[model samples]
Target: MPTGPALRIDLFLLAGLFPGLTHAAALGAAVDYAVAAERAGFDGVWLAEHHFSAYGTCPSAVVLAGHLLGRTDRLRVGTAAAILPNRHPIALAEETALLDAVSGGRFDLGVARGGPWVDLEVFGTGLDRYGHDGFAAALDLLLAGLSGAGTVAGDRHRFPFREVAMVPVAERGLPVWVAATGSSTVGLAAARGLPLLLGMHDDDAAKAAMLHGYARAGTGTPRAGHASTHLALVADTVEEAEAALRRTMPAWLAAAGGSERIDGSAPPRRDAGAYLEHLLAIHPVGPPARCVRRLAATVSTTGVRRLLLMVEGAGERRRTLANIERLGREVLAPLRRLH
Candidate 1:
């Protein structure tokens, strides 16, 4: 058996409002999945944030994280990310501290420099805030407010406060995971001694390259363990799993559409079929043994101790619940022994 750090498997909730499902039901399903994940012995649940789109219904990842933290005693609840570009860092930091206090430190705060989508305009952050400088300013304040004696000040993006004290401080000082898809974001996170939340679309080799980039950008010592997300499903056979994904995922992806630009220009429509094919080829969307091997390879190649699995692509509550249970019993159990 391979000996190393223990594997921590988590469920990644996108809160997708699938076809024929009402918004209420979609959100409800996310809650149900989190509860089931805990019972199935999964280590944690990470919520995705999106706004003004059916691709994902949850606008506030922190709010859902707090609720799930209340729902499960031992399961760690986190944001796969809260979109920093659309939020005030101080406000997000306060919520992070509050959730930390209430959940007894079971909350993880992962943030991302989201794209130049309409969310920026709607949140009043503007299109300029989509730039790296804007994201860095916001992240600086967030980090300071979480780690300092409640005094955070920044003049960038029209946000400047002088020595304001943030109450209900998280005494434990929670680690913030930066979601990175490119070198700019990876370097930003690495410079501050932060961990990364890598995306699912990238293969193990690509993800390994990103990890190497982080090492090159940062000091020698790594501060926190990084996390990697992968689309996952489990069935008796590969054909069954692939067929189920084919039947449901394309609709969900198509519904997701393209990121709306603020300047009234339509973004290019993503080929849902091609993307789905890519994910099936690269991800662990198969039987238990196959999933175990793929996930183990991910850990070995990227050296990421945390794995967030997207097992809800089938868009059916019953099927997702069964997938979670099977993952725990078959895939996660076997992987845990090896690591």
Candidate 2:
């Protein structure tokens, strides 16, 4: 369990891609937000990966990290998750290593087994074969390769050498994070002593159950981290913030494949009211003082060592960025002082 002081906060680039925003615009916003987060005393900024979908534009998070690295001075840039199956271990290792080197070792790697059947089908990658066992194997190889202990080789690709090391290894090992959505994956990550990055779509009970299972399987007091993301807009009035959330919630939930439905309802179905309830359940959305109180409560209840704020929803980019700035200045700052 996390002890003493509140968990470190990070600003997540949740709205990496949207219908109105172009890929270049999204990337630019991400880079700009990285600088903003650093200036606002954030611990890091995380970019997500998605493919062939307007939900997110970042098909290659490593490349995005490289761009962000050149733009920011002290901020640690990382992928909220890079889908492992879409990438070869050696290539992934090399790309991450290069980014780490360029950023002067300010890189964290978060990988997931993959998400959404549509994405997997588009990539021609089958989740049938790349389930738990394959994920563990790939993770083992990825970690070993990243840590400079293993050689990568196969019929299609090879890093051929007796004891070749992955280049640009961090002075300390890069923190490898596993994005776990299910209990089994959470347990696997914990049992393997890896940090877990819980996604935003999970409900309170589901999240708590996953974390509890993780604790049960975790060994030797390993550190745990998680991020609860939703449409956050901290205005002077809760009504204004809620109104913004209402506008963005439907589209945002739709893009997430309508997974926010938790009332025994089938997914991919949009109900504005249900979605708003779902968003309120997961995110800290309100006025600044209220937002701070809510966030602190979430941290205490969840036992997550990190909190990631996603001020950007499927709303206007400029408005979202302005909200992010206000959140950092008003909400997070006071929370930090309280802690």
Candidate 3:
């Protein structure tokens, strides 16, 4: 089993696009956040992709990954997931290999089936189930291309130039993870020997069960260890932490596709306060010591090698910055010690 602390940072940060914030500002903040995260001693930072919504602004995670990889030399940059079905497998493989070359092999590609439901509609993915048949087909094609397995094509994947070699091949195998949450998806990833990029909402039991099932179902050694991200904040007191959550979480969750559109046509932004219980129950949202304990327990329980904390969920720019700094300086040390 994996040992020692491997705390990382994940940002789907949209504080810049909250109701009162400017979209340009949010994008700028995202760039700065990546730079700052590197400076603050984060292991890696993953960018999220979404479209046609206020949830996240970046549609092209590869573009952002290239930009971020250029900005920071030490911090590994990855896509929390780049929805694979949105683009062709060969194109994705070619671009991924090129980015890996440029980044000195620091990129980790996370592939996922469409989600937020709206994204599926937007991407025109034919998969009836998010983690089932269509996604599996795309993944097979993508992996084959990445592995330089040219001169072949699957029935579901129609491509050209069978003799043309997939160029800009990675210096080493480019680490790829299947972003999964459901049991079937988890089993699928395991069966294929692909590592998992698990979602944030699952509590300990669900996460543990996934691991158990993976061990039972996986075909071969997984390429990389599993990773997960969730809400994490550190304050001086529990009340202060709760207050910060009350201020920022509703907007954050809504941005995460947690709510629905009431009018039957668009998203419904629900009350952040209404979800507080759920948040507090699952995340490390308290004072520094409490935060460390929760994180340590999670690490101990799930054996998740990479734990990405969503400190930017607080929404307010200044508060988000402060939380990032403090968590890096404060909570991380104790958790590492625990590990």
**Model 3: per-residue lDDT, tens digit, 1-339?**
336545554444432366566777777778888887777777788887777657677788888889889888898888878888777777888889998888778888988876535555555653342447767777877887677454435462434444556677654666678888677788878878888887777877788788888989998658678887778878888888888777766765666554232223655555556665676788888888888788777777887868877766667777777887887788776677667
**Candidate 3 stretches greater than 4 Å from native:** 1-16, 116-131, 148-163, 255-274
The candidate with the higher lDDT, 1 or 3, is: 1
Candidate 2's clash total is: 0
Q: Which prediction has the highest lDDT against the true structure? A: 1
lDDT of 1: 0.89
* Candidate 1: pairs in clash: none
Give each model's whole-structure lDDT: 0.89, 0.70, 0.73
Give candidate 2's whole-model lDDT.
Answer: 0.70
Question: Per-residue error at 104 for model 2, in Å?
Answer: 2.1
**TM-score for candidate 1, residues paired by index:** 0.97
Per-residue lDDT of 1-339 in model 2, one digit per residue for the tens?
335746577877854565567778877777777787777678788878877656676788878888877888887788878888766666788787778777788877888887434544555655642577767767776777676543444332222334555565544555578888787788778877888787766655666677788878988445435555444668887777778777765665566563222233465555757866777766677778888887766666676657777766636777776876787788877777655
Candidate 2 regions off by >4 Å?
A: 1-6, 16-19, 116-125, 150-164, 203-205, 223-230, 258-273
